[model samples]
Each structure stands twice: as structure tokens, then as C-alpha cells.
Target: MSRKLSPSRVTSPASASVEPSTPRATRTGRRVLAGVVTSGVCLCLATVPASAADVPPVVSRGVTIPAFYTPPAELPAANGALVRTEPMSLGLAIPGLDGRPMPGTATRLMYRSTDSAGQPVAVTGTYIEPSAAWTKSGPRPLVAVASGTMGQGDQCAPSLALEHPLTLTGDTVSVGYEALAVYRILATGAAVVLTDYVGLGATDRLHTYANRLDQGHALLDAARAARKVPGASVTAASPTGLYGYSQGGGAAASAAELQPGYAPDVPVVGTYAGAPPADLTSTMKGIDGSALAGALAWSVSGFAQADPDLRAVVEANINDTGKAALKDASTMCVGDALLGYGFTKSSKWTVSGKSVAEVIAADPAAQQALDKQRIGNLTPAGPVRVATGVHDDIVPHAQARQLAVDWCRKGANVTYEPVILPNLGDKILTNHLVPLITDQGNAIDWLSDRLSGKPAVSDCWSMPLQP
Candidate 1:
């Protein structure tokens, strides 16, 4: 049976929406993006079921997503209240449609969270309670898995990807590769909560791709929301850990720093931030002419979404090609983006014939926005495990190392691990992804120990970084 996603009526601050005057809201308000504010469009799903019709359905629909995702007139100020939820068998999230029994129970959840401008918004995600026993910890441990670069479209949300893995970015062999990490955390009997970020999953709003603070808010709030989920045994005292690689890594690291002020009540014990793009300015320059150059387009759109001044600057500097590329980028997932703009240079899209990096560096407003996105300004409250491949080209390994150095200087307990892989001629492709795969199991082991009350020792003393 074809089903739709329906909104659950719950009174919370996020349900009461208001005009967000933030830079992102202002720009989004002026434009008519597909998911941002659609008018009664019914988006049908090509149903993929978890089991044969005879077995109870693991997946079912509630209401049309385009209709359910749009923000309401008044959002409640309360953060992290469950808005709508539907019980989904965990197998529905696994790929290959194999009849293997699910490892746990999952609930597709829509919850309340604040956006970049501090306005309440409904954010969607999944709360999975693994059937495994909590063998090594006090109170059930929870891990909030932040996703890497998915895309700006509503379909790219992690919650959706969990259900229909292959369609997320199109041409990916193992669309459910991310599930490996989730399953790793689950193997330890720790429940996992995966977020779709602010606009990607919960609302039709343009995903504020890497708006640092906003991503941080979404991550921390996901931890808060997990406990309140029905049928889940989690509680306020459950120890929490955060894990994310690349874009997700940035969110995890940002949440670590922002936790003290943004969501202090969240008892985050450890954070594993692998190959995080902590410094956007340096990262943009590093990946400038690489195969992943489309990332530049995604980054600018994200900045413009958060700050209007940057949007105005973008409007003034971008040429027709740039405008079209931006418009095109707003609708594409990561796979489509790479294929469409692979190895493309930003200089070709600008009016003045300067590289987009150069243009952003020169403009004060753009510079400020980029600077704000950088991690390490504040120290993480608990033990932090930082991993970086020595040859990482996309997100410079130096910046990742610097994150550990900076946190150490601030008296944070930091364990810095430099992933030393044998040389592959091209550092861009292999270097960035290899560490995520190779070191992930160890990272999970480290986090599991932390949740089990094992004290973390800072490794900053051994790996000295240049000033």
C-alpha cells in the first residue's frame, strides 16, 4: 500500500513558527525553493517494502512529504519535543532488501529544533534502539550519528536514506555504507540517533549545508530528542557520544564546542570527529581544482542561506554561469553535483575572472561568515578523539591536526590520531575516504570505552603541530 508522511500534532516551541530575520531566512524568504515552501504538491514515493506483503509491513506512509515538511506560521519555542513518529522495522533501513532480521526497532521521527537564526523549526531524523544489551556501560549509551555531505534536497535526508538508501545520491554502489557505522555503534548496545540536519530532513527549507552553529544546534538537539522517544528506554541521564565523518564530523565537533552554551543539559561524554573540515577557508582552497570542486557551489549556497550580506555579495560577483550553477546546485544531491560540476573551477563562474576563493577572501562579509564556520574557537567540554589522514587533500590534514592542537591549548582532553596510509598517487580520492573506513571501527571502540567510564588520555603532548 502507498503511504504518506503525516505531521503529528504536538505542542512545542518549534511548532510555533515566526519570521526568522537571519541572513539565511531573509534569502530563503525572497526565493521560491522547491522544498522551502511548496503549495500543496503531492510527492509520490515508489514504494520499497521491507518484507513480502504477508509479513507485517516494516514501512508505511502517513502524509505527503512536501506538504508535511513546510514550516508553519507559528513555531513553538520549545526545543526537542517529538512532533510525529511512526514505528518502522529496522530492516527497512538496511540495503539489498535482504530478509535478514532487523537488529533493533526504529521510529521515523519529526522533532523540534532551532535554526540558524534561533527560530524554532521541525527537524526530522530516526531514533534506533538496538536490541543488543548494554554490556559495558552505566545507563544505556546513545550515539548521535551526523551524516557527511548528503545534499540540499529533502530526499537526501538521513532518515529517508535509511529507508531508501540507493536513491540518496544516485550512483553509489553501497548506498547503505553509512549504516556500517550505525551498526557498529549498535553492536555495542548503544542506541543511535541520526539527524537530517535543520532543513534537509525535517522541513522543506533549503538545507543550510554547513552553517556551523546551526548544524551544531541540530546535532545537540537530536541527542535531547532521542530520550523522549516513545518505547525507547533512554533517559535524561544516559551518557551520550557523537560520531560523524567529513560534514558530519564538522557537526560533531561543533556540537562539542557549542554544548556548554547551546545545550548544556546534554551529557556528551565523548565525540569522534573524523576527517572534519574544521576550517572552510583553507578547505575550499585545498579542494579548489579537485574532482570535488562542486563543493564550492554547495558552500557558497550554504553561506548565502545563513547571511544575506554574503548573498548580496554573491549576487553582485557571480556571473550567469554561476547563477545557473547555484540554482542547479540547490536541487541536486551529492552524486548529481559531482557528475554535473566535476573538477570545474570557480574562476570560470565569476564576473571578474578571479577564483571564487579569492573573491570570498577579499569580501569582508563573506570572510566573516567563513571565519564563523571554523571549528576550535571554543574547547570541547569532554574527551575528544580527532582523526585525520596524513595525505588528506579535500579537508587539509593540517587543519584537522590544528583542531587537536587548539583544543589542547584550551585544556580540553584531546586524543589526536593521524591516519598514516601508504601513498596512493591521488590524495584527493583515496586519502579522504580511506581513513573513514579503516579507522572507523577503532573510533567506535574508543567511544565505547569512554561511555564505559574509561578515562581518556590526551595525546596532544606527543603530536606537536607547528604554530
Candidate 2:
């Protein structure tokens, strides 16, 4: 039996018709690129039942999340403990020429992980066991995939995306854009585990978007939990790799750094962190008034959820408009955000008409909380490939490059690749997203080499000279 969300939870201001100031040419180009990518994947619009028997569904941003996402009352003491698992459906697969299904089988799972506040939390994700054999030298490798900016809503969980590649309900829109990469990885006979982060799928709390500790722990714990899944091919000896872009890139990079002490048992051979949002201060400023401007509210809401000091600061300074925007954005997915708040300015949400970044800059406590989310402070373990588009103004190119630079200085083996492409459009997401599509093949090959025991050649010695 599915339960309806409370009236308070369902109310949102996304219905207001507000269009962004993007030029028609830029919008057309973006749509064409997006369509080409979507069509290429042969995405199916079929819907699977989102509820389990005797478990009530939870609603977020007007979308119904499966009951399997509900956490048990008492969690295990250890991190990465398996809470539950259910067979999942993949929307991107087709009947292969050989009469076997393309890609592989999927499992929707919930696992135990620690939050940014050091509290026990449930993280949801999907695990794909490839049908293809591991042709490489070692046993079947596992790649822990962290999705780019999906959103703060529970419905935006990547596990849910495996079941429904595209969701278009009233006022809510979500696309499983990561399916392309996941299917490709599966084709290589590598098992893929996709983390939904700390709170995106769990019913207990709101998603702590981009919280370094929360996201990093969730990702590493997913890798840990994947090995424990019943009948899974992945084992303790499996070579693990971390893969992500944009917000996911930060999480993967954070996991790589945190794995040395957090979960040294998970053998992470390599990490591909593309266009990581390493510096929140820079990223927040870059995202403001951009196509995905609603992300500002997500960052603030996430920080507030993890830090009480930041929450207090937010409550004191946010105007009614800001409060409404945050409330609305809390339930939004990336597509909903794009439609509802594209090119929206953060200055409108503040009491003093200052952007969220400016407000955080003024407050010592808020600045400190955000500083804690910064990556590149610690050296990442194992080989890490950091790639960024030279024209990516969304996450910003310089900060992502600086992460590789920081790791190189720390004596970590780092391969830094600068993707030089013509600027598609400024602040329209084209400049940021195009490189992700263009550089994805190279990134995958780089990680595959490391997984095959090929030593990575570091370009740290020449990084200062190139950029």
C-alpha cells in the first residue's frame, strides 16, 4: 500500500512559470546535444512498480519512492553493513543479437553508512553484475560510480533511475543521465555500484548533497556493501575503481582520499574524477544565475542539515523568498530544477540581496562549515585521473585542475588531462557537459588500465608548465 505525502511535504512553488534568459540558439544547441545523447541510449519509458508488498511508499518532490528504501529501526554498528536488497530493472537494456539481455542484472540495495555528523544513516544504490566475462588478467573488477548532480530529492536516486530512466510526472522531471556510462562499464564486464549518496533515497532525512564526509563515506561504504551482496561476483580481492563527474567527481575524489583510513579493506586501484567541484566557494559562485542555479539552495540545505551552526546562520539570514525557494528546491531533481529555476539568481533568496556565497563569506561559522567540504586537502590513495574541460565554468576548470595539482604536490600518483574544446555556451551547461561526453571514453580507458595492473604515468612534473 502506497502512502500519500503530507500536504506540507507536497506543496511546492515550481508551478510558477519563469523562463531563463538563454538565447534560442544556445537552447537549441543544448537540446540537440541532449537529444542525440538520449536517443543514442535507446531509453525506454516503461514504469516499474516502485512499492514493495506491505511496505508503504514515501513521496519526495511529488514522486513515489519504493518501500525498499525504508531503513530498519536499528542499524548495525559497523559502516557499510547491508540493510536490504531487491532485484531491480534496467531501462537502458535491449534484447541482444545473441538472445541475451544487454548490460546485466541489477540489484536495488540499502546499506549502512555514517553521516557528516557521525550518525548512522541508510544509503541506497544499485549494483549491476555484468553478463559478459572479465577478459582482463585479474578477477572481475568493481567500479563504484558516483552520479553527477542529480538533485536533493529522494526520487532523484540513481537506483530509481535504473528502473525508470526518465520520469515525467506533474511538476517533477528527472532523467537517469548516468545510464549511458553505467551500461558502457557493464559492457566491459565490470560490475558497477552506484551510490545515491547519504539521504537521496532514504525516508529518514533529506539528502545531504555534496557533503564531503557524507558522500565520501556513502560511496566507500557502497563499495564495501557490494562485496557482501548475495551471489555477487565481486569479492574482497576484486580491484575497485572510483568513477564520477561534477558533484560525483568530488565524491569519488573524496572517497579515494578517505579510503586509506576509512575502508582500507576496499582495494581502490584507480579513480577518475572529472570536472570535480573541489571548491564549494568557487562552485557556488559559478552555479549562481547559471542554468542549474537551484543547486545553490541544495548546497545551503545540505550544509544546514549536516552542521547546526550553518543551519542557524541560514535561518537567521534567509528571506521568505529564499525560504520558499529552498523548500521548493529541496524536492526538485536536476530536470525540475532546470525547468523551475534556470538562470535564477541566488541574490533574490537572501535578506540582504547578497548571493549565498557572499553571505557565507561574511559568516565565520558558515565559511568554516563549507571549508570542511573542500577536497584536495588530503592526498588520494592510489592512481587518480583528474580531467576537466578548459571552458567548464559551471564547476570551473581552474579549481578542478588545482585538485590534481594539490595531489601531485602531496606525492600522490596523478594523471591530469585538460580537455580543450570550443566553448559551446557560457553558463548554459554546454561548456560544462560537452566535455563530460567527449572525455568519458578516455577516462574509462585510463581506469581500465589501472584495474589491469598497468602503472599510471604521472604528468605532475609538467602540470605547472602546461596550464
Alpha carbon deviation, residue 417, candidate 2 (Å):
0.7
- Name the TM-score of candidate 1: 0.83
lDDT of 1 at 259: 94
lDDT of 1 at 32: 28
Model 1 C-alpha lDDT per residue in residues 1-467, reported as the tens digit of each score: 21111122112223223233322222231132221112212222112112123222111111124334444344445687776677755534443335434567788877778777666767788899886789884988899999987776555577767766666222222144577788789879899999889777544345777778878888888898899898888888999999999889999999999999988899999999998889988888877777677777777766665666666667678877877677566555666667777778888888999988899889987788778788999989799999998888888899989888889999999999999988564625678888899999999999999888899998778866522
Segments of candidate 2 deviating more than 4 angstroms? 1-56, 96-100
The lDDT leader among the candidates is: 2
CA error at residue 397 for candidate 1, angstroms: 0.8
Query: Please, what are the lDDT tens digits per residue for candidate 2 over residues 334-388?
Result: 9989988999999998889998889889999889888888899998989999999
Please provide the root mean square deviation of candidate 2 (C-alpha atoms, Å): 9.6
Residue 162 local lDDT, model 1? 74
Worst 10 residues of 2 by lDDT: 39-48
